[model samples]
Target: MASSTASLISLQSRPSMAVARISTAKPVQGRSFLSFGLRAIPSRRLRVSCAAKTETVNKVCEIVKKQLALAPDVAVTGESKFSALGADSLDTVEIVMGLEEEFDISVEEDSAQNIATVQDAADLIEKLVEQKQKA
Candidate 1:
């Protein structure tokens, strides 16, 4: 009768061990709350992504300044018009092409035609970068 009780206890203990093994195997299913909390945690990639954005913007600004023949000391706040810098249609085309090449992005002819200010160009470049990433 003692042996029978011992075996029963072992059987019960074995099930608990099996449960622990299963839970460890599938941690998400085992600790659903923990998984939920972990999923909400911010990722390191987010910081890198934001940094890349800042770099891209800075690069775009530099490219624009070079293409527009603007002095290095000049600020590119993105509000200056292409014509304001004495950029004719051909010069603007070259500028747009430079932007596309530097960013590895495409700017539609229609979109390019609509961009009037320096800020508009920067905004467009940023948008293009975001769109490419999503794709």
Candidate 2:
């Protein structure tokens, strides 16, 4: 019985190495810095309210694309935020201003400070829009 237990422990401790015979491995090309794939990985992204997520993502992407001098059709969908868009402090301020103009609303300097990402801006704007519409 002891020998059987010992055998079981030995089996558990053993590493099973399955050799996969490689046929061909194409080298992955280095991705461009502006590529959206870098930020698509969820662990690297920011979280925001569902109501504002989509619009905010698109707006932020627009800002990034514009800054990078990309054409109008440039895609900026979900998962892209200020950091992923490569926005700096001045750019953030400009983006917030643009958002204000787009939404036709007032975003106070103090209130704007609390915003950290495109999602944050979108959530705030969405709530503000809802409040204004209700009123």
**Top-TM-score candidate index:** 1
Q: What's the TM-score of each model vs. the native?
A: 0.53, 0.50
Clashing pairs in 1: 78-118, 78-119
| TM-score (C-alpha) between model 2 and the true structure | 0.50
lDDT of 1 by residue, 1-135 (tens): 111111112124333321111111234534432111111222233211222355655776677779878887877754567788778999889889999998799999999998776667777888888899999
Each candidate's number of clashing pairs is 2, 0
Task: Please identify model 2 stretches exceeding 4 Å from their true place.
Answer: 1-48, 53-57, 67-75
> Residue 72 in model 1: shift from native, Å?
3.1
lDDT of 2 by residue, 1-135 (tens): 111111111122323422222222333474322211111111234653655657556765576566556567755554456666566788778877777777877888988887775567777787777778988
Give Cα-based local distance difference scores for all models: 0.65, 0.59
| Residue 60 displacement (Å), model 2 | 4.6
